[model samples]
Target chain A: MTVIEDALFDLAEHLDHPGGEELEATVLRRINEPAPFDASPRSRVRTWLAVAAVVVVIAGALVAIAPARRAIADWLGIGAVEVRRVDRPLPNGPSTHTVPGSLGPTSPAVDEGLQIATAQRRVRFTIAVPRDPTAGTRSGVEVDSRTPGGLVVLRYPRFTLVEIASQGDVPVVGKLVAPGEHVDPATVGGAPGFWVAGAHQVTYLDRSGRVRTDTVRRSGPVLVWVAGGVTYRIEGLDRVTAARIAASVH
Target chain B: MHTMDRRSDAELVSGARQGDLDAFAVLVGRYRVSALRVAYGIAGSEAEDAVQDAFVKAFRKLEGFRTDAAFRPWLFTIVANESRNRRRSSSRRTKLDLQVRDQPQSAGAAVDDLVAQRDQRRRLLDVVASLPDRYREVVALRYFAGLSESETAAALSCPSGTAKSRLSRALNMLRAQLGEEVTL
Candidate 1:
């Protein structure tokens, strides 16, 4: 046999030249190889048990932190909630007389670290959400409440969210909405909710080790709230981080 | 553009980074079949496996994807690498060079039979599959990927001279394998 000079241009044609369309579904299924999130009922129970592990850590962190830093900012206004005067001023800097700030609304958005310095104190935190996309494996429901259309349907038989709020300052990675505030008219977290509207969905593991998603939109001053077990956040993450996520949201 | 339309690729990357499977899926859908076909050409029957590896790897490493570069090329690069790996691991060599030399010279073939003669396509696929790994890589980078000579060289991490010679020799080998069926 001899060589041929011309190569196949049937790429578009060949792709359209379906050898087997079922292979697409097969590849997708085989690709995921959906290993059990919990190999056994025992293991599933163990995963739920691990959620308890973070409780101690959450309690400890909250114990050392303050409730809110109310120095004030130009665009943001403080609510009627009481504020403590600590030496550690607000994050980034001391807020003047506008909005009160915490480490940030608890969202996965905190992955990028932040540093705020003023005469009083300096607040610092790091975002530690695991960003592996292929796994798509979470114990319960994987959701996208950031947008009304951002919801991801879960086929699992059971899905649940449990919120365990700490008493005071637990620089948690989640949205920071007042106890009863709503961005639009959504009932979130049993408390009124202010959802983060933006391109990126920030994720964080709460004190319970449950996953939380946050986004930041600058349409209005960003509001922060925790609903379901996940945190609803906007402008709660770093400007660069928030901007990055907001840009991707469809 | 509306606010939704105005989002940047960086944002999309970030969203994908946060386990937003839909965002990542959108990214995957864009490269889906193009990636599959390239993998298919290089991977042959194992195209499905190679495409899966590429998609999974691409999705996992998406944080490293820069918004500025064309996502398609980067995706193909991964698919190509996975296909190569699959070829190596399977160790399934079939020595399927063109068999036109074995053909009987009965020139009385029907029209449908003449047109349906995939001796050429089969030979191209066979020679490419049988070439040395390095040369085969160049051939695929050229035809399967449709890269220019320089692009082919760059993709193969070789000098253009090496890439050109590899492709030339690969074509020559296929022609030798096909004998009379060699088009050029």
Candidate 2:
């Protein structure tokens, strides 16, 4: 190998990445073993046996079930934003303060004000801006770093574009759409996307994994899509207009 | 039965296919770090979850494994796919800030040389990060994860020639960015 090629490999050795100490145990536990919870001996043995049997059964059933799980996760989840068809939407009101310093009912207004460049620097993923003049005239841009992959809110005259990063398996934003709500599969920028119209519950998963219900805005429709490792949600626009604005994002 | 820890991957895979969880656990213990590294290369901070999911998925799909094929590459392909899928579904909140570990100073090594080496390493990392995803992935799988060219191709779900060309392109791009002097 050339010196540069060798250097590349040598550099990789020193680059700090996560250690795999817990990984083997975690993977094994998920696949086979039951959780070693503290319990009375008699019950523990029963529980162990029961859970072991269940694990065996589940292990065998996983062949049939794993694909179904992937399909469901794929269908309802658009990267960071997941849309669940719930039996009933949360009471149509602004979200109450459930946790200390949790996001209250108000949506985009909660972010600390910052310049667009500063916000861009603070985030790992690229911040896409709509090129369309109608949606491009940004009123403000704010950064909320409370989530793993920070959240950026770009306010326009007619719509709000909220970008959240999906850095892990955890769902960053969860939307509960009721039976009557309009939830349709969409294609934006040649990538799969979703369009949700009408009232819905928008919950934000905080850094600590707490669910913070964002206020339900009955104002207009919302366009959600995952492109280039970021979930983009545009609210307050019709489907065609939202698609156009989403396409203009670069 | 043969001792589980020292058994070849093929042996463990065969045992695991026959419903031996211990054999699979041994395999998990062996490949967890490599899988995590490959996953992190693609999925960033989400590598842990992606790796865990990949292993579970691999376990479920072990029935389809070809007896003669290498296991690590097959497993890595799943890791790469799991990471990519999760990455596609997720967006970033935190930047992937990779740091170099502090190395013990060599006996009588010049301070200036050490500083220069550190600077070069940092520049190399920056350039690698800036490369397009395709090129970046090849560098990651081949050099970072230490996969062989064929292994990299298998993990990428591409032909060996494609992997070879991509790695060459990636190296050329790296050399172009870092300049030829660094190579010497």
The TM-score leader among the candidates is 2
Candidate 2 structure quality by residue, lDDT tens digits, A1-250: 8888899888877675675577777776555421111111223233122212101111010111122222223343322323233343345554553221123443332455577899998777898899987775688877765444567888888888877664433343445454556567677877656677765555333321223334323334677776666667788788889999999988
lDDT of 1 by residue, B114-134 (tens): 444445555556655677776
lDDT of 2 by residue, B121-172 (tens): 8778878777776787788788887999999999898999999999999899
Q: Going through the candidates in order, what is the number of backbone clashes in each?
A: 47, 9
Model 2: reference contacts kept, as a fraction: 0.63
* Model 2, runs deviating above 4 Å: A33-250, B1-4, B93-96, B104-112, B181-184
Docking class of 2: acceptable
Native contacts retained, all candidates in order: 0.20, 0.63
